[model samples]
Target: MLKTLASYIQEYKVPSFKAMFYVTLEVIMEVLIPYLMSDLVDKGIANGNMNIILKTGLFMILASIFSLIAGALGGKYASIASCGFAKNLRKAEYKQIQDFSFSDIDLFSTGSLITRLTTDVTNIQNTYMAIIRACVRSPLMLIFALFMTFKINSKLAFVFVFAILFLSIVLYFVSTRVHPKFKKMFSKIDCMNSSVQENITGIRVVKSFVREDHEREKFSHTSDEVFSLQRKAEKLLILNSPAMQFSVYVSILLISWFGAHLIVSDSMTTGELLSMFTYTINILMSLMMLSMNIVMLTMSISSAQRIAQVINHKSTLTSPVNGATKIENGTIDFENVYFNYGHADEGYVLENFSVHIDSGSTLGVLGATGSSKSSFVQLIPRLYDVLSGSVKVAGKDVREYDLKTLRDNVAMVLQKNVLFSGTIKENMRWGNENATDEEIMEACRLAQADEFIQKMPDKYDTYIEQGGSNVSGGQRQRLCIARALLKKPKILILDDSTSAVDTKTDALIRNAFMEKIPDTTRIIISQRISSIQDADKILVIDDGKVLALGNHEELLKTCTQYKETYEAQQKGGDFDEQ
Candidate 1:
């Protein structure tokens, strides 16, 4: 996981190295100050030598100034390295998500992905800063202080060494206990984000159903779980502070007590004992910083693994090398096509579904809920690949064509019509980036969207709210259809996209398709029989199998399902068409 994350530090390597280098210089200067102070006290002060006192004090001040400068430079470089590394990491994760197939997206939720891209990346970024700065400074400070202590008095150095050993043991115990709690806490955070996202996205439904209290309770439950886990982790973390204080106080007493005996025996100088005290404080403070960094590492270890999961994942779907780029016609054939949502144990959503449509013909699809109507059309654009057999377009297997080229020629307005927040013209341009105003208006007219758009004060320039919330369902559906129409695709599919529009408007949109773009193969999926009764061919499917396939008149005579649906819709006033 560390290796995977380290790869994103590509251009920030220099900054990282410079941070460590400057920190090393800072530690060196700090060690020199304490060493010089010992001499200033033992010879300059004890002997009452004014010259020696002045010279040694001057050297100590110089070391102090250099340490300040080095510390400042170290902080600057660490900031640059960490923030740049985060940028590269965030870009990598986002780019990888773009490459994922629909199946890959299914394995993760929108909320989880958002958390990984944002929260998880932030955790890793903060940890990176701590690692480059404190991780280098603390260890180097401890080592240099210990070296100076041993040089001044080896017997007193043992006191610092024993204290270091005791603190390490305590830190190990705290980290081990705390790490699992922190790991679990972050996972709970993912769940909380998922709940929040789902609630906000479906806030209207919750309001309509009077379920705001239920959503609030649900969110509170996840939030409480996160709080509980973090509190438990922090309970263990609090041990570090008391442990550090105990070590510092005990080491001081041991050094002071043993040094008094050495001084009485004329074995150690007063100045050396005072310097030993300073080195002890330096070593203990370094340990405190090290412990703090360890706490950060414990938290970030979990976050880093979460981030690695996203970065290391390879999309199962990829375009073929030197793939075919041209689609000859709108002709589509399902030849013994067997498919599931990449879950073989769940049975196929489309089971050996074989059908052939001639170029530029209109086909109607009728099915009950769970009939996989949308799944059938999705294959035409290669949104999902078949498990067995092949889905062919333009007399070639879909897998043979370049993914972008195949999808470009096939436009699909799915059952859930979606529009992004933008001006009416910008949203339409998603269908054709280079489309002119004349071209866009023509497509909207065909989709029966031009009438409503012109009624708005801004017309083409009207701003759409997020998720197209500013428009009614019918308008949203028509706008999506218009966007698809702007593609000028060879094959256009409406997967129950017009369900919200009245029958009269639906008929007008269908009539426009037939009249203005007769050569573009149109496949319409609808539950109401009236919407598809005029098609050249109608397929009635259930449970991933074709129950009936024929023209409207032929199916009325032969297929019980089609006849019953048509009669039921007619009796219920589903349409006024004769």
Candidate 2:
């Protein structure tokens, strides 16, 4: 994890190194000032020499000013390096997510990814700043102060060694107890974020069902879990302050008692005894800073691991070394295809699936909820690769084609229709960025979306809220269909995308597809038989296998499932009339 994170510090290395250098210089200057004061008191003040005292005091003042300047410069550079590292890490993770296949996305939850990118990255960034500044200065200051104290008087210096040992032991024990709780706290944060996001995005549903109280309870439960875990960790960490203070006070007392005896024996001067006291405080305070750095490092270790997991993960699907770049036609062939989401030990979602669609033909797919209708079309655009056999588009295996070229040729409007926050014209342009204004209007007209769009105040320029929340379900479906039509793909697959519109609008959309875009292969996956009854061919699938395949009239005569479904809808309509 350390190596992976360090790799992101590419351009910041210069500033980071400069920060460490300034910290080193600051520590050296600070350690020298107390040693100089000891000299001025002993040799100059004791002998009544004004010249010695004045010269030494001037040097001390100069050293103090330099230390202040170095410290300020170090802080500035540390902030730059750490924030730059965080920006690079977020960019790398987001770019990796863009390349992931559907199977890869399924392995991680949206909430978990959000936490890794946001809270976890911020934790690591703060830790990096602390490490560059405090971690560098603490050890250097401790070593320099220890050397100066031993030079003044070795006996008082030994007292510091014992005090440091005690503080070290306490720091280790407290950190060990706190580390696991911090790890658990971050996971609880993920849960809390997930709860908040779900409630906000689905607020309309919660209000419509009068379940506002239930959502609030759920959010409160997750929030309390995070708060409780954090409190437990903090309770352990709070012991560090009292332990450090006790060590500092005990060391000061020991130095004062021992130094007075030395002064009486004529072995140590009064000025040397005063310097011993100053060095004692410096050494112990440096240890306190080191202890705090260790605590922060411990907490950030969990966050570092989480960020590395995203940066190091390799996408399961990758473009072939020399993949095909051009598509020949709209033809699709699924030959002996078998696929599962991941576990091969479990049965495949599609087994022995075979189909051949000629260019410019219309094929309707009918299936129950879990019959894998969506999965079947997903393979064509290579959203998920087959576990065995091959799925071919335009006479080449999907895996053999360049991912961009294959997906560009085959447009899919998935089960969930999505729209970004933009004007109606802006959303339509996503399918074809270079599409002219006239081209945009023509595509909307073909999708049966122009009529409603014309009624809006802004017409084609009407602004759409995020997720197209400002539009009705049927209107959103039409707009999405129009967006896909602007792509002018060779193969267009609609996975129950028209389910929201009335029968008349649905019929009009189908007629537009048949009449306007005669040369594009159209695959319509729908529950309504009326939507696809006049298609060139229809497929009836059940339990991951094809139950029947023929034109609608031929299926009505031979396929029991098709005949029963059509009759059930007819009976429901007649009952409504009565």
Candidate 3:
């Protein structure tokens, strides 16, 4: 984990090294002051020499000024280095996420990824800043102060050794006990974030169902779990302060008592004894800083591991060494494909699925809820690889083609319509970055979206709220369809995308596709029989197998399932007339 995180410190190496250098200089200057004061008290003041006292006091003041300047510079550089490191880390993680396939994403939750990117990264950032500043300063201060104490009088310095050993043992014990709790606390944070995100995203549902109290109770439970784990971790860390204080006070008392006896025997002067007291405080304070840093480092170790897990995750799907770059046409063929979301033992979502779609043809897919209709189309773009057999697009195996080249040729409007926070024009531009105003309007017209967009105050330039919350469901679906049309892909798959719009609008959109973009293969997945009844071919899928494959009239005469579905819908609403 340390090595992985260290790689992200790409450009910040110089500033971090400079920060350490300045902190070292500051510690040296601080350590010299006490020694100089001891000399002023012993040789200058004791002999009634005002000149010696004045000169030594001036040196001490200069030392203090330099120490202050060094400390300020160290702080500035440390902040720069740590913050830059964090920025690089976040960028790397986000870029990695972008490269992940759908199957790779399924391994982690949205909430867990958010926590790792945010809270965990913040924790590592704080720990890194402390390492560059206090971690460097404290150890140097402890060593220099101990050297000065030994130089003044070795007997009292031994007292510090014992105190240091005791404090070290206490820090080790506290840190070991607290580390596990911190790890558990971060997992709980992931759960809490998941709960909060679900509630906020589904707030409309909660209000309509009058389940606000239930959501609150669920959120409270997750929140309390986090709070409880944090308390347990903090309870262990709180022991550090009292243990440090006890060691510090005991060392101070031992020094004062031993120095008094030494002064009486002429082994240590009054000035030397005073310096010993100052050095004692300096050494103990450094140990206190070290303890605090250790506590922080312990917490960050868990965070670092979590962050490294994300950065180091390799995508399961990779492009072939010399992948194909171009597609011949929109033709798609699934040859005896078998697929499952997880391992093969979990059973296949699409088993032995075989289909051949010719270029520019319209194929309508009808299925029950769990019939793997979406799963079948997903294999065309290689969103998830087939477990066995070949899924070919334009006469080349999808895995053999460059991933970007394949996906760009196949446009998909999934069952759930999503729009980013931007203007309607901006959302449409996602389909084709270079699409002009005229081209955008043409696609929207074909999708039956132009009328509604013209009704809005700002028309195409009107801003869409995040997730297109400002638009009605039908409007959202139409905008998504228009966006996909903007791509002008070789193959377009609409996975129940027109469900929100009225049947008349759906028929218009289908008709527009036939007239405007006749050379593009269109696959429509819908539950309504009316949506697919006019297609060149219709498929009836159930339990991951094709039960019927033919045009609407052929299936109605030969297939009981198709006949029954068509009759039921026709009687329910007289939909057959349309």
Candidate 4:
């Protein structure tokens, strides 16, 4: 984990080392000031000589200023290094996520990945800042001060050994007890974030269902779990302060008592005892700071591991090194395919799914809710690799083509149509960034979206609200279809994308596809039998197996399920209603 995290510190390494350098300089000056005070008291004050006193006092003043400057520089460098390192880490994690396949995304989940990127990364950033400055300075000050105290009076210094031993035991107890709680606390935090994200994104649904109170209760439960865990961890960590202060005071009191006796016996001078007190305080205070930093490091350790997990994870799918870049046609072939999500024990979402879609032909897919109709089309663009067989596009295994090349040639309008917040023209360009205004209007015309767009106040320039919330569901679906059409892909898969629009509009869009883009391989997945009755071929699948493969009239005679669905829909007369 450490190795993985440290790699993100690339360009910030110089600032990290500079922080250490300044901290070292600061510690050296801090240690020297006490020694200078000893000389001023011993040689100058004792002899009542102003010259020696002035010289030592001036040297101490210069050392104090230098130490302050070093400390400021150390703080500046630590901030730069830590913040830069965090930027690198976030950038790397985001890049890795962009390359992830659908199966890879399912592994971590959206909410969990968001928590790792934000809360976890922030924790590690603060810990890194402390490590570069306090972590470096504390041990240096502790060792240097301990050495000076021993040089002054070795017998009195043994008091510190006892005090150090005491503090070490306290640190051990606090660290061991607090670490486990901190791990649990972070888990609770992730849960809380997930709850909050879900509530905010789906607030409209919550209100529609009158479930605000339920959401509040759910969020409160997660928040209370986090608060309780944090309190417990802090309760243990709070023990460190009193233990540290107790050691500091007891050690100082012992030094003062023993040193006063040594001075009376003429074994040690008053000046040396004064310096010993100063060095003792330095040693104990630095240890206190070190203990606090150690606790923070312990807390951030789990965060670091979480971050490393994302940055180091390899996506399950990647294109071959020298993969094909050009697609010959829109033909799709699924050869003895078996696929699942996350793990195999979950059972195959689509098993032994085989199909051969001819180029420039229309194929309609029909299935019930869990028949994996969407999963079958998703394989064409290499969204998820099959477990045991190959998905081929344009006569080559999807994996054998460059990911961008394959996806660009195969446009998929998912069951849940999505439109980002932007101007209508800008969003339309998502399918083709360089698409001209005339070209965009043409695509919209084919998708039957131009009429409503022209009626809008701003027409092509109108801004789309998030998720296209400002527009009706039918309008959003039409806009998405227009955008997909702009891709001008060899293969176009509309996965129940027209479910929101009226049957008349749906028929117009299908007719437009047949007329305008005749050579494109069109795969339409729809529930409305009227939508697929005219297709060149219709496939009826159930339980991951094909029930029938023929045109509409052929399927109505051969497939009982398809015939029943069509007849039921015709009798009900409102399957097209949104």
Number of the top-ranking candidate, with TM-score as the measure = 3
Over 4 Å off, model 4? 575-578
TM-score of each: 0.97, 0.96, 0.98, 0.97
- Clashing residue pairs in all predictions, respectively, total 0, 0, 0, 0
**Candidate 3 local lDDT, 444-472, one digit each (tens):** 99999999999999999999999889999
Stretches of candidate 3 off by over 4 Å are 343-345, 574-578
lDDT of each: 0.91, 0.90, 0.91, 0.91
Q: Poorest 10 consecutive residues of model 3 by lDDT?
A: 569-578
Off by over 4 Å in 2: 343-346, 574-578
TM-score of 4: 0.97
Which run of 10 residues does model 4 get worst, by summed lDDT?
569-578
Model 4 RMSD vs true structure:
1.6
Locate the minimum summed-lDDT window of 10 residues in model 2. 569-578
lDDT of 4 by residue, 445-556 (tens): 9999999999999999999998898999889989999999999999999999999889999999999999999999999999988888899999998988777899988988
* Greater-TM-score candidate between 1 and 3: 3
lDDT of 2 by residue, 511-537 (tens): 999999999999999998988889899
Displacement of residue 523 (Cα, Å) in model 1 is 1.3
lDDT of 1 by residue, 1-578 (tens): 98999999999999999999999999999988878888999999999999999999999999999999999999999999999999998999999999888888888777778888898888888889999899998999999999999898898799988899999999999999888998888788888989998888888999999999999999999999999999899888999999999999999999999999999999899989888999889999999999999999998898899889989998877888989999899998999989999777898999989999888999999999999999999888888889889988889999999889988999999768789999999999999999999999999999899999999999999999999999999999999999999999999999999998999999999999999999999999999877898998998989998888899999999998888888887787764344
